[model samples]
Target: MKNRNQSKKPKFIVISEQIISKIISGELLPGEKVPSENELIHNFQVSNTTARKSLQEIESRGYAQRIKGKGTFVLNKTEDHHLVRTLGSIDATRRGFDEGLKVEGFKPKTIVLEKTVLDHGVSAEISGKSYIIEGPVLKVHQLRYADEMLLKDETKYISLKLCPKINMLSTDLSYFKVYEDKYQLKISDIKQNLSAIILPPDDPTNNFEYESALPVFVLDSVVLSRKDAVLELEKSLYRGDKYKFAIIAHPEYNGN
Candidate 1:
């Protein structure tokens, strides 16, 4: 049982949520200066650490960006550069990246940075389900681009039991096609979770060159075959400024 009277959220989170609501409501525009630590401390009557953490929380969620000497500012959202990607019904088959981008008149490309075969199995939890991929899995690190613009930095873990000798395939081709065409595996469904995150400045896996922290969409995905056999696990970082996801919603009816 949980305590009903206690506050569930921390002070920093509360402050950050308020600021984010302002941003969403157009009270704060892109490139506009955000409240500094001192301003937040004075306005909220909170400590310096709490104020700083609040700002950090906002930036981490892709709502704001900080300058070295200057104060933090709202991240610029360019409608022209944003590519709208529609997410269909959950049971509908997913489209390949190449096909989706091509339909939008953009040339898609994948550049493999590294590939390795692991000795032990990889374990992951997706959509409340736990899965352990057997040993001899293939690990691939790659960058995905649209025309000349970088869009995604992706890492994939593939079960060799389902895709044996997949390391020998051309890294440039789409794995989704290879799974169905070459391996004769029927992909049943894909499970994914998306969240806004900031890539650390010093992270070695970060291939993007940016002066400040980079805001991205971290997409965790699990690919399944017929009968719920796990085929692959992927962690992909999509550039927040370049991509926008659109999903359709239907209202549920409760009989009156």
Candidate 2:
């Protein structure tokens, strides 16, 4: 269970903490049954509404979910991942992803964003190679829009060995989809580093427009699998105006 010291917060918050604790403690594995509403009420000395509300909070926080007749069940929440973090097979409809990609430009070519490969002090478990992924990280530049306005300019890196087809990709395709559907790889985890920098190769804005903009947001991450295999290390610059990120913590099972 997550070791959270007790605090005199709202009852629902306290209950939520306990639920998180249990998941961390391993008492509640993914798909495990949570206490029924009646059990929760009796155990917590709370009302039915409060119990339900606690469950809702858990769900909203990305921890648990309620099935039609099956009661509340633990969800398999992903460890927050980043750097073109595949909002993996999301409920796109709800998130407005159904809005569709306005492909302003899709080009696959060699971009040397990083000049040299210094040891990142990390090793891949799958291959146990000392270097980042066998070759230079190929940066795929993408400019997409949901509507008329500029959406995001993406510079994603793919290891040459893991993604040889990337060199031949003629048009824009969902990078994650291609990896999963064609390559049979699943992005199980991601670690990200986000910072603000004066936008360089990523933004479409010319020097004239620079006066009105804030610094760009840079995201660097190495994606991995459940087996600790480093899939790819990616570095991307996002148009600070067009991209926003949200993170929520929930109880989840991490592919044990």
Candidate 3:
């Protein structure tokens, strides 16, 4: 009976869960080596395949990372930061990255790297809707730092038709704030898509100074003004090693 019950769940999953529990309980410290496959096989009396899968499972869940030729190690939990941007909300979407970092107790700084006016404008597709931002788009490239740590690299294309002479404004200021305060444009919607990407070493835009290829989160966003007019398009890269994103969800109808 006990054997029959044990067979219901995969042995590798059980082992991985135990390891995860250890991590959650603080038994495994950051940068500490995780158990080797041989150790897991010996300890659990499992086959090599099961042991390998167990480690892979832990790494997939982001609790551990594998270092080539060395072994897997726990990631730093204390420094792992999360950006809590609520989805489908105007106010939350308007909260600037600098403000978010400051709320998290980190001093934030913005550095403008490049700015140019593209007379031909740009094309973008958001939420299955196509947009052709009319000529004379202002492209702003910048880097965001949190407490002296490079956290984000971003490029924003603002429609000059909607925000003329916006390129004259300081790039260090938040575009969202500028759209609302200076232009009096109501930012009604913001659509975002997030995905994991490997930062290529040869990519010119890659500013990370890691010896190995870095993992990053790519955020593509479209900011819309009143009447669903596309105001801006943004492509931002975040350090995957240091940051995570959270979305707040609530029931549509409360059963009060």
Q: TM-scores of the models, in the given order?
A: 0.61, 0.44, 0.64
How much is 120 displaced in model 3, in angstroms? Answer: 1.1
Highest lDDT among the candidates is held by which one?
3
Candidate 3 backbone overlaps, count: 0
List, residue by residue over 1-256, the lDDT tens digit for candidate 2. Answer: 2334444567887887788789667566544557777888999999998888888888787767676675776664435211122322232211222122211111223222223222223332222334255454455555544334433445555665566656566434555566666777777765666667775443564321344555567666666554665656655555565554544356798999
Model 1 over residues 1-256: C-alpha lDDT tens digits?
Answer: 2444234778888889889888777576544567899999999999999999999999999888776675776764445646655443232223456544553445788888889999898877777888777888999998888786789898889989899999888776668878888899998877777789888768786777666788888877788898988898888888887877666666898987
| Model 2 TM-score (2 dp) | 0.44
Order of candidate numbers by TM-score, starting with the best:
3, 1, 2
Point out where model 3 deviates above 4 Å.
1-78, 87-89, 249-256
List residue ranges in candidate 1 displaced over 4 A: 1-79, 87-95, 248-256
Residue-pair clashes per candidate, as listed? 0, 5, 0
Model 1's alpha-carbon lDDT is 0.77
Off by over 4 Å in 2: 1-131, 198-211, 251-256
What's the ranking of the predictions by lDDT, best on top?
3, 1, 2
Q: Which of the predicted structures, 2 or 3, would earn the higher TM-score when compared with the native?
A: 3
